[model samples]
Target chain A: MDFSSKLLENAVYEMSQLPGIGKRTALRLVLHLLKQPEDQTSRLALALENLRKEIKFCENCHNISDVALCEICSNPRRDKSMVCVVEDIRDVMAIENTSQYKGLYHVLGGKISPMEGVGPQDLTIASLVKKVKLGEIKELIFALSSTMEGDTTNFYIYKQLEGVPVKTSTIARGIAVGDELEYADEVTLGRSILNRIPFENSLKAN
Target chain B: MDFSSKLLENAVYEMSQLPGIGKRTALRLVLHLLKQPEDQTSRLALALENLRKEIKFCENCHNISDVALCEICSNPRRDKSMVCVVEDIRDVMAIENTSQYKGLYHVLGGKISPMEGVGPQDLTIASLVKKVKLGEIKELIFALSSTMEGDTTNFYIYKQLEGVPVKTSTIARGIAVGDELEYADEVTLGRSILNRIPFENSLKAN
Candidate 1:
């Protein structure tokens, strides 16, 4: 689209570089910012710049943090012996929101994806393996997504922990709560049946 | 949702303020930026801040510009005697994209909406009238949207130009190209019928 001002064009171009935003949406967003108060625009700019400049990662888990160790890694109440491994910070947030798990997390930053040129070395997999080799973690939960990349990363890490003495497991797969079983995918449905929980254990949750 | 870093939370909050963006999408965008190179984040922030701080408005038309008078308004090839009045810069860009209009523009910034507490006084109506009184423009095209607010803004501006020597007209409304008559809304269909053009004139185009 033709823009009357170069500044407007530049701003829209930069905004459209974001993951999901397109040119038209970027223009709309930039125009909205133009209509807003200067203070709002300045605040947005400042927040983004400061976030990029000052943001930190947990030295232990590689999740985004404001200090050397993230809150979860620093918390004494969280179970250090039971580490739930995830692909990124979003997974960490999602698992934390469930409020059912009191274990600590080891964020891998991303899963192994050969198509994207991301592999074990590109992520925090080595650090996680070293942490496991320290012999403190008693159990390692593979909480990555059920995609091929997730499975590949989980298997890679599992292979690295072959003789590390930590019991390993994956998160349960089943029909989501409030979802009809008929609508569930075949693989998930099949897995759910094969790994069916005991009746008394299911009744104990709710 | 909780964020491990205060800076990340602030950036997400500011990003979610844009139209159509929500907390989840905001988090995704912020995290995506965090994963990108530092220069990418800095460029986006700098572009937005600079656009807001250094943008200019055309003195003649109130459209966004990088100069005192916008390119279209300052162009010698444009018809200074014919002005297309619009609600905002987006309309100007849309019309420009059609490559059909050769007239100057007068951007009102917004249509008058009483429900939203927007009045004629809040827009660029006064400066537009002043321009009309200068006797340079011989025709005024009301190219605002076909809404109640658009009509109110047009009529209000029309009243302001009472006894002025310029001819006034609104853009024609009709069923869009490739749209079936049966599916067309009643108001637009009825207006299209009543304002039907000569068959020869329609055949002359395309």
Candidate 2:
């Protein structure tokens, strides 16, 4: 960890501050940047600076965007009545890639993880509640992960919408589409069986 | 791989350009940066910029440095007659950490890798040869990794130093200090046996 230059040390230290990158990895990355053309480093630094300073979050869904409202939230074709609530923008991108969901998304930013000192207020829960109270959304799908934190966040939001006339539901928990039943976890397999849709209804989709 | 924002996409793309980092990991890192305070991003960018713009290479050894001459190259106590040639500054740092070597280092910047289109001319081999030709160095130790490229680079440099009044040696290739014979690779184990040192010489070191 003995750096020959203060500049090199500072660069590596800052790079190592990133998640999952160690000092060695930071050094390697910084060395790589040094090896590359100066333009590459300039472009990378500019992109990161611009993204942090100028990037916007969707006012409606809180998803990362270039403008006040993201493309998804502003799109007229997307179903506004059914809003899929997610933990973050990554989840939104994951769902969008599937092209299966026609409804809109409401990103929670993160779950209610008391262990990390991230409570309900830390997320966009209040805005979500206000959106639901406006009565524009008919169905609020809880698309958060099935962890304890995810469950807590979902329940907290559900409680906030008490008697608000919104039909709250959670995403289906089951074996993935192409996964082998034998390899499925016990809880997921059990839930898949318990929540099995009618054979005719399943056939209608495919 | 569709990004919600152009700025986010650019940052992720630039990040993914780093060795071993893919799109998913880049996205994760960019999102983590976004969640952190804006100062973190600014400082990281600034450090990288400053490092790239202001970094210097030692005039004597070509090691990355803040000034024309690195600390090792300028140190009066170091053995100027015995020079250890290495692949890069990382190797220099690794050897320095051992604290066993008192000789100066000559960083070649990189090995001669034909597969990667890196030739001997691309490195500081010519300068090293010039230094050796000047008759200041009594011995030159090759400390590059034991790979085809490393061997090629070493041989190339050795050929360049032909007829020069200097001793040429390579770092010992053998089983690690504490490695078990049973688990050691056959080549290393065999080499270790073939190049066994005198019992008295081994006993001299702690």
Candidate 3:
């Protein structure tokens, strides 16, 4: 689209670089910002700059943090022996929202996706393997998505823990609590049936 | 939603303030930015800040521009006697895209909407009237949306140009070109029927 001002064009170009934002959407957003108070634009810019410049990732879990260790990893009440391994910070946030998992998290940053040219070396796989080899973690929970990349990453990590005595497990693949069985995908339904738990254990909750 | 990092929370909150963006979308955008290289965020922030800090609006037409006078208003080739009055810069851009209009433009900044606490005094109506009173303009085209607020604004401006020796007309309201007659709204179809033009005039080309 032709913009009247170079500044507006530049701003729209930068905004359109964001994921899921197209040229028209970027123009709309830039125009909205132009209509708002100048201070609002300044605040948004400052927040984004500061977030990128000053934000830190936890040394242990690789999750976003204000310090060396993220809140979950630093908390003494969390079960250090039970670590949930996930792809990125969004997964950590999702699990935290559920409030069911009280263990620490190990954010791999991303899955091993060959299509995207992202290998295990590109993620935090080495650090996670080293952590497991240290013998502090007794149970490593694989909480990545049920995709080829997720499975490959999990299997690679499992193989790395060769002689380690830690028990490895994946999150359950089952129909949602309120969802009808007929609506469930065949693969997930089959897996849920094959790995069915005891009738009495199904009723247990934290 | 709870964010583990205060920086992330601040960025997400600021991003969600944009029109049509929600908390979930804001978080997704922020996470995508985090995944990208740091320079991308810095460039986005700098561009937004610079756009707000250094951007200029045309003094005559109130359209966004790099100089005191907008390109359209300063161009000698444009029909200075005919002016299309629009609500905002977006309308100006939309009209420019169509390439059918060869006249100058007057950006009103916004429509007069009492419900939104925006009055005629809040817009650039006074300057527009002043420009018309200068006696250089011979025709004024009202190209605002066919809404209550747009009509009120057009009428208010029309009253301001009383006895100014300028011909006034609104953009035609009818079934859109290449659109089905059955799909046209009742108000538009009714008006199209009542204001039917000469049969031969409908066949005229640009």
Return the TM-scores of chain A for each candidate in numbered order.
Answer: 0.84, 0.85, 0.84
What local lDDT does model 2 show for residue B165? 96
Evaluated with lDDT, which candidate comes out highest?
A: 2
Candidate 3 chain B weakest ten by summed lDDT:
B197-206
The CA root-mean-square deviation of candidate 2, after full C-alpha superposition on the true structure, stands at 5.1
Which of the CAPRI classes, incorrect, acceptable, medium or high, describes model 3? high
Model 3 achieves a DockQ score of 0.82
What TM-score, over all chains together, does every model reach?
0.92, 0.92, 0.91
Cα lDDT tens digits, model 2, B1-206, are 88889999999999999998999889889999999999999999999999988889999999999999999999999999999999998999999999999999999999999899999889999999999999999999999999999999999999998899999999989988888789999988899999999999889976
Model 1 ranges off by over 4 Å: A175-206
The DockQ scores of all candidates, in the order shown, are 0.90, 0.92, 0.82
Give the fraction of native contacts in model 2. Answer: 0.94
Q: Which ranking of candidates, highest TM-score first?
A: 2, 1, 3
Docking quality (DockQ) of candidate 1:
0.90
Clashes of each: 0, 0, 0
In candidate 1, position B162 carries an lDDT of 91
